[model samples]
Target: MSAPLASLPPRRLSWQFLRLVTPYWKSANKWQVRGYTLALLLFTLAQVALAIWMNYWSRELFDALEDKSLNDLLMQVGTFVLIFILTMAVTALHMQVKRWLQLDWRRWLTAKVLDQWMTRGHHYQLQLVGGEHDNPDGRIAEDIRIVTESSIGLVHSLVYSLLIFGSFVDILLTVTGSATFPGTAFMVPGYMVILAFAYAGAGTVFGLLLGRPLITATNKLQTAEADFRFGLGRSRSNSESIALMHGEDIERQNAKTFFARLSQRWNRQTLGYLGIVSFSSGYGALLPVFPILLMAPQYIAGGMTLGVLMQAAQAFQKLTSALSWPIDNLGELAHCRASIQRVLSLYNDMQVLDEQASEPQEHRISVAQSTQHELVLRDLCIANPDGLILLEGFNQVVRRGEHVLIAGDPTVTISLFKVVAGLWPWGHGEVWLPEGPAISFLPQRPFLPHASLQSVLSYPQPAEHFTQAAMHHALECAGIAWLAPRLTELDSWDRVLPLRAQQRLGFARLFLQQPAWVFIEEATDAFDPKGEEGMMDMLYRELPNATLLTISFHTGLERHYQRKLLLNRPAQDKYLTCSTSECSLTTAPVTPVVTAAD
Candidate 1:
């Protein structure tokens, strides 16, 4: 992230970030990208041509001004108008084409990042692990915005400067004629090139000494601003709690203080910009006078025409533009480097996580579709973030329609269910599930997306994706028939509805869908003892042939299941086999004490 440094370690800047970008170009749509790049190349050439034309116009206009010829002035004016019109037209068209590329590139980038994030369920796993830094949404929205827009601007500036340099070099050399240097046959006008170089070098050095520190400051300031924005968003999301607790005053105080710092940085940035503007303006004003001073005597003495003298002045200004590249584009260059560095850091983090997950210590997890008719786990071992092995050297055969109760500590057993459901894959294991799987997973806190009741029931898809009858039946069966009228009404269900009602809707979804495998992670705990029993009875009534895998800490849940499995942490006691009839792992009347001594 030390992007302010003039020279970054090549290994840190583009190397890793380029790795992330490599996937998109390698995609099936790479031809589209190739075409886009080809178009960009052509666009660049056209812009360069325009720049050269601008240099020609600058010289021609100045020469006309000096001679005061009415006919010549009219001719120059007409030519200038035509070229200026062309310039604006080309600029507008280029923007349109560049926008097309931006959208395509953004679409491609979003899909690729989302695919990887949701690919192996990395998005969910990221929440549980160090992938908090993944921030895929941020990468998709903000980071991509900066990377795209800034890149286009950077490319345009570069091409413009280079073209100006190439075109103006001829004028500069022609003006010098050849450096006599006290007794020489003329040195091929190298003296003019040297003069331009020295001026550019001096400007860059002085500017850097006074202003380079601003680039470093800008980088830090941006990071701080992002952090502050995240904080505000966090508070906004918890507005309800904040209001109830009457913490708005505190929030306002904090935000005011935060924005105050932001304003301070903004002012510093303004000062830096002003200093740059002052320097460039001074350089620009002196330019016209400078060429005249050098070549005016030569022109009056008949060494060259009024046209040639004016041409040399235009050439000198254009040459200076080329040399002043760093000074001219300092802001954009800093922003680009900072953005590139961030993406590089993110890419490196993902790679590091990939390596750690596959290492022997973490037991690299693998997933495959069940070839046969059953869900099977061979040599399955689930673990904690700290490498605490929960399920070790395990083998299990899940028949098509067996209700299995996993009766261990709530957390570890639920993790096992996730591992089996193919949601969590951080631990070392093999989960073999049936092909074209239909599964209904109910976590302790079910996710209810903001949508209509029907869409909420559908959860991950639209209401139109499923039949109205099916959704109605689900609501009725789950004892939520009242919600039937609200199926077409769309609102934020997460905020409007209570947790228990959401769980009822969840159960209704399971009952309606009737998936072959139903994974419940302490979902039924929402209801009281009577309600739990009634719901279980309804579940059995609906899906008599379906398999139910429940994870619960409550031992009372054991009686409802035909099979039970226990799990414990890695750093704790060893795992021992136990039977349903009698078990020594349970000594507490209500709590289960698991140990190796069964």
Candidate 2:
């Protein structure tokens, strides 16, 4: 299993978190974000001012009660009503401004991630190599959300705490006065502030020790949740096959296994939370009384008014809460760290893929566009991902308006087609194609995007590029005229259409596209002999000048082609000779005369 994200050291994790967040403040939307942020800060300051006022008001109201002054009490109550209204207005505006900033930041970040993932086929390469990024969809859809929301929340909370602490600290110092050590002459000013710091500092240390394992637990939970969701999606996508095979029990067991793993991680997370709550609950309960206890002596001795005592207690609580911010939000911090790590890992992997893709590899097959009107391969060598040679030092050339057939081992034939299409480039030698020529590739299993039938047929091109009459004509030629009337209907055509119909649709698209060159990789396998013959005839008649290159095992269609290219796995000595020097190139076996068409 891959290591959990929580395994990263604190310093590295913090750097990654900063990397993820810094881009937004530097993005194109920075000005708008700054405007919203500035508004939020202004509102925050207003709210803090109101809170300080209320803290003093509490003292005054209590003193009014103590002196039995009804007039003063009524006036204080009226002032309280006015402050409450302003507080409510500032708070509502503050929340909306903060939310706007979060939305803008999330949008920019999501777009940036998508651009990186989709560029240069990085998504495909990630799947091909099975990289560390497990679920890119989850990273974009879920992890980005967590990072944005948590980051904004953390900023808001920290700002609020700092402002409150700043507003109250001086008040606390003034109320508590100076203190002299019991047996020494050493004196400390603002001793209440000092005590609050020491107390909150201890709580922060304890919270960190107890919550150290929570990060790993949270990462595990995310992984387990993704696995469970993947299983459910797989089951749904293949429900028909499962029901037909009566494999419901097996699928149920698979689902149960995924859920069990998720439950185990969830239980571990809950246990971590239990430890946190046990300490925090008792710590929080003692806070209010602790402040009053220290100041109660002065109030009882008549050295301070009831109002002064109340004000001092409230100030102490606010100061301590600010100092204890990290302790209170330990769980959220862990969660945010995990999410930031996941997103940064994905972004970093995509960057690696993009760089690797852009760099030229010595082992890769060289492809170039030529001025000549022909397809040429010189000393072509195709290898599997494991470096096993499939085709050694192969060479072929097909000029314009020529029909050719390629027949060989199924794997070798398909790999050669992929190399020519520039999809699988990990090979040797060079491929030269006519510059600016339109080329189409038809694979064994056609891909039909989930879109309107018209859009699916025109794929990679807009539906408006072709007229209704042209679409109908192509469908009739490919022997699927029934679909011509349903051009505007939208559905999952790949799943909805039978395999034969899907292949026919591919041919229909080929007909509509009418490219100058067509490369077929056993795309007609689904058709019967008569149907194949009819489709081949239609293709020949429709685009008589278009070059055709086909890879097929069947000999029936050989008559349609003017030439054939056959691949043979020669003896070790012959293979080595071909590899070292291009002198052994031949389309025929040494001792026998054979054709791919035969």
Candidate 3:
């Protein structure tokens, strides 16, 4: 039974939407959300009460006009002024309350999504392992806004419509009462209500059928829009590179391609809207005359007054409007559905990542804290996600205070660094680390976060953690003292600073932190040999007891390390072979080289 229910299309979609939105209602802001919800409910009830009063007023005004009673018409006109003022107040308050709730919900949702996306480097993993979530930034920024506003608007409209239907259905039944055909025994009770239902129900069925393609079209439009925006952002970020390469034409063509796809989806949505409008317009235009046509004989026979005929028409309109919600807002419904699906897809992906991290796996690298003051890798096997072995059966230990250089195929060396840093764990291995040593890893191109120069220098740490004097000293030792005075200034320091300056800053951070263990991945490659030597000399001078593991192609740094490790891969094999060489202070120069078969 549950399986069958799950197989139902509407139920599946509703379940997905509820799952995506339930977190907000149950979140820490539940009390505030409930307060806003209560206000909206009261507003909706007020509107319904106003509608009922106005319906009766309409009948009274019309009957006064029909009888040519000037005094009654003047009194009804005064009543109209009061009703209009109250309606305006109610409408304004409703809109303000709705907007307030939308903003609060959007704020909470944005924070929640950002936290989930950024936690545990899940955002990086998503980019590395591409899947259905193409552009998370758009989902968090644009889709969340659409979902919150549209869902609230739609729910309010739906609830109000239902209230109107309930209040006016009895009025319609009372006015139309029962109809009997002449010379026939058949009688249809509350025929006005039944006619309104049948008319609106048919229109709804046709509306849904005509609007079915809109959901897919809207989804495609959103994706294409995100892709196009991303393309524009990428072009802006890489403007300097493009300008240097004179690739303006290529970039323009890429923009045109993305725009073309977006336009195609827009055209499809337009066509879908055409069908919906054509049907809904005709259906709605005929509603006012429907009740009149059904009761014309009673008015002609003097059984119904002009006011009663008008009242019956008004009640029928209300009942049909309530039942025609799907027909009126089908396009919005499609858009809401698409937005909900996109957000839920992102949420589900994050959940999947969390689940994968928690579950035990046979191939996961075993990591533990060790009593020994060294970093150890025992029988380590590193492989890509596709199971292509990069390094296998490798066992090694780097004791405390050892300066070692690993020279290998750039890919393998980088992978090894990531493995040791515990970023890449899709392999069989056991890694043991000294229990209480702070470690830092610097990659080939250091990351300078978008922050104050001080924050960027002391990153993964707050700006206040280091004194201005310490930062100045580290900068001077790293041979980039020119940056010391600008530490307080904030900007996109990553883009503002030159490559050599950024690399110098990485070392500056290392000097300030003075971690017990440091892993360097070609961090000094951007610097000239003399500059590289100066930075290396500063490292040895400042943190003499720190264990240094450097991965670099330049053999010029060979004299700085007391030991060397090399990785080799033969053409016939899939795994790497590791070899180590120990050197003494007086040993002759030995260049460590890594060769991999094509």
* Candidate 3: residue pairs that collide: none
Query: How far does residue 86 in candidate 1 sit from its true spot (Å)?
Result: 1.7
Cα error of candidate 2 at position 438, Å:
5.2
Ten residues in sequence with the least summed lDDT for candidate 3: 582-591
Provide the TM-score for each candidate, comma-separated.
0.84, 0.88, 0.89
Clashes of each: 1, 0, 0
Worst 10 residues of 1 by lDDT: 582-591
Candidate 1 Cα lDDT to native? 0.70
C-alpha lDDT (0 to 100) for residue 253 of candidate 2: 100
Give me the runs in candidate 3 sitting further than 4 Å from their true place: 1-8, 182-185, 366-373, 568-598
Positional deviation of 513 in candidate 2, in angstroms? 2.5
Ranking by TM-score: 3, 2, 1
- Shift in Å, residue 215, candidate 2: 0.4
In terms of TM-score, which candidate is stronger, 2 or 3?
3
**Global lDDT for candidate 2?**
0.82
Sorted on lDDT, best first, the list reads: 3, 2, 1
Q: lDDT per prediction?
A: 0.70, 0.82, 0.82
lDDT of 1 at 64: 80
RMSD of each: 6.2, 4.7, 6.8
